[model samples]
Target: MKALLLVVLAALPVSAKLVSREQRLDLVRRARLRQAVDPSTMDLLNGPQGDGSFKVGEAVSCKYEEKDPLHPLGGHSPKFPCWTKSGERLKVKYKGEANPEVYGEVAGSRLLWALGFYSERMYSVKIVCENCPADPWTSTKESPRAVRTFEPATVQRRLKGTEVSEVEGEGWKFSELDHVNPAKGGATQAEADALRLLAVFMNHGDNTANQQALTCLEGDPDCKAPVMYVTDIGGVFGGKGYFTSYRHWTKKKSLWKDAGNCVADYKTTDEKSNDPEISEAGRKLLADLLGKLSEKQVRDLFLGARFDDLSKRQPPFIWPDGKSRPLTVDDWVKAFLEKRAQVASARCPR
Candidate 1:
């Protein structure tokens, strides 16, 4: 029976549609689904996603494939760009101390989901790559790239429901967001502003046009209106300067540029985030989403992202008294709540 099932699955045609930004935008314009900001689903928080585990067999196995220079994976770390055994494709993000993108991306993406935003379904796992190299990152210029025995390393499966535009950097910019910000059917200005507030709160570093996506949930047959989301948020939490600047993370909590005008201070000042024009509803949304997280959830978020430990390569720091203090999951939880309060409490004076 299992053999027959495998055969049937292998014969099935691909169901996903990789459309252009314009095409996806048109779908949103004519979307049938309610895209309202104040939907019934907004009433609850989704998750802090636990320990980031995946059961056996569910783990995706990928053989090394060419890295699309136009859309490369593993910004600083080693990545296995390959097709999986499940007849689907995804990039496997490997973890390392020198490459803090692994941890930041995991925690950042999870935070997006918890706040009711559509995001990449990244899960932590351990697996061996078939016919791989010791350093999977070597370009084609290197010789004998194929090796049979590769150690089982921690990799996060970047699930796709998220479609890419063939034209590089062809994503929705913050300025051109009126169509999808409050999208056409549902999302409101307040809701849109709240999302902007979110990016600032995290000090999102990769605030580029290409890092966002317009995607329908993976199995949606009737996806007239796909939700637009930030596809890459791995550059969050540690600020734009360093990948895991726990000190920077803890220090930067102020989120408002002008409380009276409802303006937010996006750490990276650009047209995409300047003067967000926040509203009361936006503040409430932040409060509603973040206020619901318990101490356990907050701790789990950072710990699961492997933020509990200190990186020796990131180098240690000393206090005025000459005492070294390691950044803990506890430090992150405190910073998260502090920033949450700053935004949630942001008042637009009448």
Candidate 2:
């Protein structure tokens, strides 16, 4: 009976066999070590077919190839460096499990590609090897792992014009816009201009992760004046969704109304939530900045349309209860302008 059992086990397909805990632990260990050695280097290891070796400072490119039936969005792929002898670059194809989490990897890879780095392939490596004490991780012994390897020259060619310098203190950094301290004073005009554009961009993109100011400077401080640019664009519309209404309870009506007054309120709430110094500083800066813009301009910038245009259209104002009334952009703009003016007056005091 024992001999029969051994024979049956031997006949089982390799892919069908489960990996032992020790083996899993080994893989985890190797992955963690790889991450510690270089956090950016092992970005692709989370994929299914992302096995193989890579050196530090090597450029890699990857893309999603297949969708997992269960996940329909996430899966794995191999990582390819920019300068392999075979002259291969680009994630030619993806073959592995499709899961939503895998979609996140694809999203991340797309972001990196947009930022301009070149390499082919991606894999899943361990993040904390020391934390994992079970099966150790190992690359597949099969030749396919090697066959997937490609030359780095091809990656360089594809990355031509996509390279973004990853210089610290020179590129993008994050910050808050509404907070101001008495000692720090308000943001300068230039800072306010940048922050205004950034706030619109963030709102349009549905980004809420960063409520502080961020600076993206080009080049080194000693080398030359840094050109400030937007660092985080991930909050844009395609990545997330946004809402445009505020809830207010009217004492007279004893009912809730969609005030459309929430955006500024939200910003104010965010500002006051910060430390006193930072909050004061941001308030002063924003008040000064808003003072420069006409109420019409603020409406146009945030609402994506002029009050006149909205008035001409006379769009219906639909209440949350499904009742609709004729309303125009002017109506919303007038209310918003009054509220903002009140806020500015209270906060800035001319």
- Measured by TM-score, the strongest candidate is 1
lDDT of 1 by residue, 194-288 (tens): 67777777777567676765445556545644566776777788676565567776565567777777777665524555556667876777677
Write one digit per residue (lDDT tens) for candidate 2, span 1-350. Answer: 00111111111111111233442222222210000122222222221122343332134443212222353321133322222233432222211121111122222232222222221222222121111112111132231221132221111111111112222112212232233221233334334322432233123232232311121122321211112223223222111331222112011121002223212212212333211221233344444444554554444332321123223333366678999876654555454455445435443211
lDDT of each: 0.57, 0.26
RMSD of each: 7.2, 19.7
Whole-model alpha-carbon lDDT for candidate 2? 0.26
> Which pairs clash in the backbone of model 1?
35-186, 36-186, 37-187, 180-183, 182-187
Clashes of each: 5, 66
